[model samples]
Target: MNTCLRPVAEQDAAALFTLVDTHRAALASWLPWVAATHTQQDSLAFLQHSVAARQQGSQYDWLILVDGQLAGVCGLHSVSAANRRACVGYWLAPPYVGRGVMQAALQQLCGQAFGPLGLQRLVIDPALANVRSIAVAQRAGFGFEGILRQHLWLHGQPHDAASYSLLATEWAVRQPVQA
Candidate 1:
């Protein structure tokens, strides 16, 4: 899985729109934003917001690329510098699911968050029904905390989410030793 995560750019709006649209039904089942993004303009606005958030040091958003093609999006959301923590979120095109692409992208982000960003902890909260996401979190070494009852409101309905976290110390312990 030749995958990489790069900062989202304004020029990627159309490509991003296509990726989302191609998997609209699959994505809409879990992500509220998918339904709201109807056109390229909407995608452009979303990208613009991501850029602004990065400029403000509030969040970091990236586009997942596989073999130089847009595969998905992933990022650290709700970054709290004072708390040294952040929340993670990600989604992939239907065709890219189950291919270890998202996992690789997530691992790369984890390194950035714990290394250069100096964050103490990172959390991934996926709806309890999102088995794939939960699996990714677990595989990436995030410890399951507990189910957050009614933690997310998607499509105007409440949904239960499982909270998972990895601390900087835990990440350090998981890193490979250099000879």
Candidate 2:
């Protein structure tokens, strides 16, 4: 459980892309969007954009490191000051999945986001077929709001997704350590 939510630095471009490419084929079963994700050049540019977005205070993206290795990536997207909410997304290297690594990462990031980011709520949308991701949300204390039926397109197919959310007030009452 030695995990952390650290900033996505500019230098992470190559390594992050390596993770994406390595997981590209297999991740589609869980990460539907990975199918539509950019190729090598585009992936590098996207990671660069992630770092740039952090600089502008418009978004916060982090690399999830497990004992110092690039285990995954996590982020708060679409931060809304007026709404006091944000959308969350994450992905872990294939080898790192199902070992409670993502669960730990979610717990750490959710705490920082709800506490320091001044966000009232954090929302996660996982494809219905992605059971592992749904489990992570559940473990991290996100309540199932509803299914956004056919609400998104992944790999050129309409997909149903489960929406989960956790609130700052809710986290304040729960145990700090996510079991």
Candidate 3:
């Protein structure tokens, strides 16, 4: 299980599109943007936007790789410089599910968010019924903040979401003590 993350690049548009297109049905329920990605061009636009966002210090996205295969994507979005916080989002292909791929990817992303990104709070809001996503957050040491009724609108309908948060201070406490 050699898993890693790399910043999303323009050249990855085709591969990203293929991954999303193949898992559209499974991802559409949890990720709203999956429905809009009907073509490789749409993915290119998304990758381009991610690059721009990183430059503007608004967001950062990365492609998840497991043994050199594009397995998914994860990112920090809705970044607020003044607030020093951001929301985390991710989706994985079905083949990589239940193998701890997302868990490792998420920890790495959170470390970036709380470290050099200089963020204080990291948020993850998964639909209430998305047990797998919620578990990822919990397993990564995020605390259950509360539920936001109808916090997310997916497939033209409002859905309740569970809010989880990991503060930089909390994350720091979880880190191993240095020698």
Candidate 4:
């Protein structure tokens, strides 16, 4: 099995901070939420809250690793037990770009969501301009749903996003069990 999502230990905060800083400026090209985070303190607080969220059992954090290096993070930002759904998000280090590391991580996360989280569907919303991210979803078996007009404002302007999704059944059929 792929070890994409693992526990984020307290010691990993430093590396996490570094990653946040290294990509904080340029990452805005694809991620808008990151612009608000401008300092190491901001990232530390984010991680602290994330840890607390995990303990409360309503959320979980997955630190993505590629070739024994920290590549990115992914997790269920929100979860509903009765509704059987969760909102998923992820990002990767620039160095790992063009590789299939994110693809493998996506498959692993999808399996965890469908299996342990009892989620019926996993959804992703990527900005239309973010071709790289949208491509990742396409490769991961998420079919385009539709565009959400002016879904979010980013980099000082409103932007539309293309919604993509994959159902548990679809995930089951698409996952290639690694030998």
Candidate 5:
């Protein structure tokens, strides 16, 4: 998919907003933040918040670029330095789906999280009904931990979530050793 991850910046507000606006319906189906991001200003606000979170060492967000174009967004959320863990979340534009772009991006992100970041564990919590997200987590080698009933409030409504996790040890074991 020729995918790469870049730190999201304030300059991306317009493009990010356009992407979200284009996929509002699809994204809002599972991601609550979609509805809230109605304009460029909203995108700017999100980028600002992401920057602040990154500075605080609490979260790291990235833009998924496929073939040099903005394809989606992915990142480590709710990072806990003390626990050496964080949750992963991502969403791709409609046209970029089924192209393995997200899978490649995720694999790279996981590598960074467990390698340079020295994280011990990573979590993926997707709504139970979100089959695509579940498949992405599985394809990334995240193990199913169980379901968290009514775990998230989306658009002011309760939703069940399927929890998945991958440990640093498991990731290391799955990696191909270089000669």
Candidate 6:
């Protein structure tokens, strides 16, 4: 599939909300904010916040398009410019799952992170129980670091998370050498 990442725009609120609403149960199980996104307005607010954050050099979010259709979202959050590190987050619609769409999107994100973004490190912290998410990180060449106890609170309960990271050096070694 032709996978691409488009910067999130105000006009995408409806599409984003529809995806979250349709997958509320599954998404809410892992993401605490999912429960609060009950309407298009909430998604718009999120997009607005993302725009502001991007402008402030704090966070960046993008819509994942597969074959020219909205399929999911991916972003770099919890950015630390001083430390040159950031954490990655992503999710795909049910129909797009298992197709390597997220994996490809992540690779592209990594390229930007390690190249123009001038970031040295990127991390993915997936709840220990989230095997699919962990797999995605592994597929994108992130090495497992360790488990963080109560790293995330979801659905009113704390959950352990498996931390994974990729450094720019590692990513460079994985890339094809330019001719």
Residues 1-179 of candidate 3: C-alpha lDDT, one tens digit per residue: 98899999999999999999998899887999998899999999999999999999999999999999999999999999899999999889999999999988988898899989999999999999999999999998999999999999998999999999999999998888989
Model 6 residue 166 CA deviation in Å? 0.3
Better of 1 and 4 by TM-score: 1
Selected candidate, larger lDDT, 2 vs 5: 5
Q: For candidate 5, lDDT tens digit of each residue in 37-128? A: 87899999999999999999899999999989998999999999999999999999999998899889988898889998889999999999
Which regions of candidate 3 deviate over 4 angstroms?
none
lDDT of candidate 4 over 36-131, digit per residue (tens): 677667677777888898788677778998756788888876777677777778888887777787888888888788997788977888888889
lDDT of each: 0.93, 0.83, 0.94, 0.80, 0.93, 0.92
Displacement of the residue 37 alpha carbon in candidate 1, Å: 0.1
Candidate 1: residue 177 Cα off by (Å)? 2.0
Candidate 2 vs candidate 4, TM-score winner:
2
TM-score of each: 0.97, 0.90, 0.97, 0.89, 0.97, 0.97
Where is the poorest 10-residue window by lDDT in model 3?
27-36
lDDT for residue 169 in candidate 5, whole number 0-100: 98
RMSD of 5: 0.9
Candidate 1 residue 31 Cα shift, in angstroms, is: 0.5
Task: Report RMSD (Å) for each prediction in the order shown.
Answer: 0.9, 2.6, 0.9, 2.4, 0.9, 0.8
Sorted by lDDT, highest first, which candidate order results? 3, 5, 1, 6, 2, 4
Please give, for residues 2-119, the per-residue lDDT of candidate 2 as tens digits. Answer: 8888888767778877788787887666666576566666666777888888777668988999999999889999888789898999988888988889888888887788777788
Compose the digit string of candidate 6's lDDT tens values, residues 1-179.
Answer: 89999999999999999999998887777788888998999999999999999999789898999989999899999999999999999988888989989988998999888988899999999999999999999999999999999999987789999999999999999899899
